[model samples]
Target: MYKAACLVLALFAVALAVPSTYDTEHVWKAGNLSYVVPDNAVLGGFDPYGFNTYVGRVIYANSILPARVVVETGVAYFNTETLSSKLLVYDILVAERNVNYVWVRSFDGFYEKGAVAVGTTNKNERVFCCRAKTDGGVLIGTLLLSQKLCIIKHETLALRKFDKYEVLVAQAKGNGTLY
Candidate 1:
């Protein structure tokens, strides 16, 4: 019982403290994991460095400067078996630029190359999926997904969307891709 009490207290502390600020409502509901976003955030269109660093709930496009566009991401699943995650980054200049959203199979495995397995498309688009191997191991580095306009972007328990703002389109949507 003491261990259970400690665990509950730890969870409470994290809930009260993890959200350092109130840019957005720092929500985690119904299996959707999101970082908090500011209400009046301005998602600029720029990403010089390739990694996403969060300033509160929204990701910072650049460490020195704030995000050109306020963004959030989360993972989803059908149940307790199948699983996937996407990093839905967005921008204001382009509405949703550099959208590096992808879905993948949750597993306890290793892969040398990325899992950008989107093939059989005869469209004219450029995509580059690379990796960043630092001390943290390999990470999804480059992003290159079909630039299809998601005209009817909606927020669902299964889809990642911008918090506090009703967005129309996204940058990318992948089923699975490893950096």
Candidate 2:
């Protein structure tokens, strides 16, 4: 009887040591970019360095990007939970048009790459979507353009895709964004 009681105590202790899936103070932020999981949403594991991407569903995403750009991708549903609108596959999407490169950070520390096609606009912003894989599935999204500049003057620039394991640490150091 004493051995069983001790085992229960050990199990309880381990449970307490594990991090909670929901944290009110857990906010993913990077360089004028920030994201907060909604109270009704369940947040999965997030990256520790650079743009910490997190997977979850928001009741309503109120412009998480810079310059108040609002986007609604689709419904986010978990195992048995009811579907919620605004499924945020990746928490943050960064595109540097000057270098003609696109970088996306996922909730589980995974990254995706894609090329940016120069858009036909006054600002000359690139109009393209980035796709990244997550534990759940593939996430397709686009980035908001901040400015328009024709530095390269090219229609489309080829972007090098990196494997999730290969660019894990390098992405944190601000490398592998451009080809």
Model 2 residue 176 CA deviation in Å: 4.2
Give per-residue CA lDDT, model 2, range 1-179, as digits (tens): 99999999999987655431221222322211234433322122222121223233222222221111122322232110111123334332232233322233433222234333212122232322233443333332233233211011001222212222111111222454533
Structure candidate 2, residue pairs in collision: 53-107, 54-107, 123-148
lDDT of all predictions: 0.25, 0.27
Candidate 1, position 1, lDDT:
100
Using TM-score, give the best candidate's number. 2
Q: Candidate 2 — which residues are off by over 4 angstroms?
A: 2-27, 30-82, 86-179
lDDT of 1 by residue, 13-105 (tens): 876543222112112111123544444322222222343322111222111111112243332111111122233432211212333433232
Worst 10 residues of 1 by lDDT: 75-84
Q: After superposition, how far is residue 84 of candidate 1 from its true place, in Å?
A: 23
104: Cα error in model 1, Å:
16
